[model samples]
Target: MATYVLVAGAWHGSWCWVEVARMLEAAGHRVLTPNLLGTEAEDEPETTEPLHRWAEQIAEIVRQEVDEVVLVGHSRAGLVISEVAERVPEKIDLLVYLAAYLLQDGQTLNDWAQRAHNADAMTNAVAFHSDGTCTIKPEILEKIFCNRTSAHFIDFARARTVPEPIAAFMSPIQISHERFSSVRLGYIECLQDQAIPLDMQKAMQAPFPNVMTEKLDCDHSPFFSMPHELVSALERFRRAE
Candidate 1:
């Protein structure tokens, strides 16, 4: 059985991966979904922790939890996994970016977002807080992140969502081909995604010529909209490796 570390994206906690983790566990694979700092609380105070702190938290979990792991990053967490791989490459067998932001070395999420075709809409939708944090308005959350998902799941997510620290988005990721690109990379694209459009996902992935790509006929929140398919895709990726 393979071990997997499922990392959630900005404004989300490990709770987002519950259904997917359960499915993976049922298939005899081990999975760990660690909540990034500040995400555990629905109303956590604006945080000062840089993006590296989030990566360190994940690296610590990787060092202590499993011998080796298939690190899966969802949404914004694509950057997080890259940073974690830099910190502990030997502990990660493969890096999976699930409709996530796959950034280049020294590129911040802001930089990537600005280059995206949907940049104007995404930027306009964000409600920035005075404390260097930001969040999507609840009214638009469903449309943006869970458009194809059921109402029940969208409601649950909205209730659990928290403010994401802006510092994390602004902090550029520090990675290198030697430390980060050595691990196998896979990308699962959500075809109907509105949060991270299909074009943007492909653009983010273009630089990584060796990355294996898979597609799902779902929206951004595949863990809720199509957990079984997501699990199947992940298993197929693992087998290919």
Candidate 2:
């Protein structure tokens, strides 16, 4: 059995991976999903946390365990995984980007999202707030989080999504790819994703030519709309080795 550390993107918490984690656990793999800084309303501005701090957290999880881990990152969490791999290369067996932001050295998550070449992106996407928190607009959430997702989830998200710290968005990502060059990379593309857009997903993933890319015919948040399909793809990829 392998241990899997799943990291989520902006405005999300470990709760987002509930279904995916259940499937992985039922299949006998250990899973860990932690909430990032500034995700909760009560949480203070930890988004100022340097990129290394995020990497160290993941590294600590791997260091305490003895099993090889599959580090899976979704959306902006890709930045965290890249840096984590650089910090603790030995513990990770694979790096999986689930319609995630795959970035290179000195690139910020904003840079990837705002690339001009992609035609499908929400060009006006903004993540800032006057109170110093970041959040997506309610209208944008529907397109990004899957319109078919239950109204309950939509309501919950509308009420709960705290403003993301600007640091998480503007902070430059620092990664030493040489450390993770040997790590196998995989990509799961959400073809129907309106938030990231199909074209942008393809563009975001183009840098990693060796990655195993699979298209999920669901919206951006497949974990909410099609848990089984998401689990199935994850299981297949996890067991591929």
Candidate 3:
């Protein structure tokens, strides 16, 4: 069984991947979904810590487990996973971006978002909180997270989302060619994603021309709207290796 480390995006915790994790585990693939530093309720604001500290958390997971892992990053988790790959490239077999960000060497998530802006599409969207933490307003959670989800799941998601750290989105990515360039990359597109938008997803894929790509006709949060399809895609990709 292949080992998979699933890192969640901003404003979300390991809770976001509970169903996905179950499916992978049922299929006998060990899955590890670590809650990023500031994304958990108990992880009090350490807005001062640099991104490398987050990357180190991921690297330590690899160091404790098998040498290499199939690293999967969803949404803003992409930034953290990429940084982890930079520090421990040897510990990653494949890097999967699940309708996620793919920032350039010096780019921040906001920089990428600016290029994909659509005021009409963003009408229901909200960014940043009073404390400078970022979060989607609960009213727009359905549109942003799982537009097609059952009302039950939508409510669960809205309640679970934490206020994301602005630093995580605004910080410039630091990558080392000696590490990142050697790993294989893959991308998944959430076709109905209003949060990132379809156009932005395509743009994110442009940088990794050779990366394997898969399209899901679902919203930004597929674990709720299309869990089976999402799990199937992940399983297929893992076995393809």
Question: Measured by TM-score, how close is model 3 to the native structure?
Answer: 0.93
Q: Is candidate 1 or candidate 2 better by TM-score?
A: 1
By TM-score, the best candidate is 1
* Model 1 lDDT per residue over 1-241, tens place: 9999999998888889999999999999888998887777754643675578889989999988647899999988998999999999999888999999999898988887887778888887789988888888888888888888999999999998888888887888899989998899999999999888899899999999999999999989999999999999998888894
lDDT of each: 0.89, 0.75, 0.81
Report the number of the highest-lDDT candidate: 1
lDDT of 1 at 86: 96
Point out where model 1 deviates above 4 Å: 42-46
Pairs of residues clashing in candidate 2: 133-163, 134-163, 134-164
Candidate 3 root-mean-square deviation in Å: 1.8
Per-residue lDDT for 1-241 in model 2, tens only?
Answer: 7788888777777877888899889988898987765566787756566456777877788788788788888877888888888878887888888878788788887786666443244544555577666677777787667666777667766776656676776777777758867787888888777666678777777777787777788877777777788777776677776
Per-residue accuracy of model 3 over 16-46 as CA lDDT, tens digit each: 8899999889988888988877777877754
Residue 78: error of model 1 in Å? 0.7
Clashes by residue pair, model 3: none
